[model samples]
Target: MFRTWMRFFTPGAVHHRLGLVCLGVGLQHGAVPAVGPRVLDGYVAVVISSGRGWYRTPDGRRTAVTAPALVWLTPGVPHHYGPDPDTGWDEGFVTFTGPDTATYTELGYIEPERPVVPLADASGPRDVIARIARAARQGNPLLEVETGAAVHELLVALRRARADLAPDGDPVLHALARDACTGMTVADHAARHGMTPAELRAAVRRVAGCSPKDYLIGIRLGRAQELLATTELSVAAVARRVGYDDPAYFSRLFTRRVGAAPVRFRAQQSRAVPDDWNEGLQEDAEPGPPVAEPVDGP
Candidate 1:
């Protein structure tokens, strides 16, 4: 009969769009009966670490809960879920909300329509939830911030795991996507992986819907944006950090791709709060100057 529950009543306005103002996190075991048939005011994510259970939706749909799976309970949605009577499972859960909630929903990252999502790997989510629980129990000074950060990490892990499950998912491409900041030439990257440039291009396009060069440049540009927004680095320094030694070329590419010059973009970001800064960034804007072909790095 291992059971622990820690609840948090967070102060309002602590987090605007995506705040962890209130959280109810815990681990439970020991034949607990189904609880709910109720509605909640915020989003709740439940991760089953072991054993089995069941979840019931407002529409009278019952879903069998299996180990290493996640169930998302959207705000204002009626739901009920709990462990099996005979083999009560271990469970970890966190409730959170923020302005970015809608953004995530729009991106299909957190699907309210699909409550139960099977996690290819559950350890990451489990560890995050455990951290949230511990922070809540200790009444840490930065509990709100800590929990909010952990929630963000949990979301990222969920998205990655889900992406990995895609039919055309390629882990190698995924790694390259993350390491795009390295600024390696497409040919060099391909050679490092024992793949010809053409084969690598096809693989990246298959999973990322873009040529390897474009994919890598997109990653570099994204990093540049982050640096511009969060740091006081000059344009040339930012360009170098993202792997471009030619600052002038980097500036042209960034302006074309991001719809604003790096300096102007940084100015706008500086004027806005960090959390809401990116709201003004243009997405999928018309392509700028045609991206030059990838060249071997010096």
Candidate 2:
């Protein structure tokens, strides 16, 4: 026997801009039918908290699905899956669509190539699923935003729960971020970690969705932004501080990437921060420039 509660939604364009929009969510119990060897227009994340099943892609590759596993049903991709009839199953799912799906895919948070993912523990992901289920109530004015936000959280939870990840997360990322501001070349950084440049590139791409070069530059520029906003360092000094000795080169790169010259950016940002900013700050009110549309990422 099967028991279920489900919700579906059609959000306005405004809600879609939240980057990820929840289209539907539901729970399933008991025997389940095999889904299509057909494609979908959007994406679905099916979480199996218990029981067993099987999933396959259009290419005819099949994977056995087990409890506490997740199956990724991506847009326009044919997927076939269902629970074992004899044992039945327990499942929860969310259907979502958004422009950020591509970004999430690049970041390795959503893996369409591997349709089925075994989890170290589904408890965390299930907790978030329960929250989304609660917001499923009809007449819930905040449903779109609430569930949309949860979609983001759900992705992170799913990533953390991946059976292949280290219990403490990726240590290389921490080491890289810690040393990023040192202005090391890709090869230099790779050597420090005993990885060839090609190997380093692949590892960083698999995890951070960017080349090692881009990640280091991002960190350096971010630190530059902080120093520019809070301190009165000269352009040359600021350049050197973030590991760029050539201030002219640094200024050009910063302007190109950040959309403003160093001096102008500092002036714009520092004026916004009152000297006694600690006293002037409100708990949840740090306003900034208008939100920019999403851009291409590494």
Show how many residue pairs clash in every candidate, following the order shown.
Answer: 4, 0
Give me the displacement of residue 245 in model 1, in angstroms: 18
Per-residue lDDT tens digits for candidate 2, residues 246-287, read 778889999999999999999899745566753422222332
On TM-score, the leading prediction is: 2
Candidate 2's displacement at residue 111, Å, is 2.0
Worst 10-residue stretch by lDDT in candidate 2? 289-298
Listed per candidate, the RMSD to the true structure in angstroms reads 10.3, 7.5
List of clashing residue pairs for candidate 2: none
Tell me how far the alpha carbon of residue 151 in candidate 2 is from the true structure, in angstroms, after superposition: 2.1
lDDT (tens digit, per residue) of candidate 1 on 183-232: 46788778878888888877675445567778888888998998788766
Instruction: State the C-alpha lDDT per candidate.
Output: 0.74, 0.83
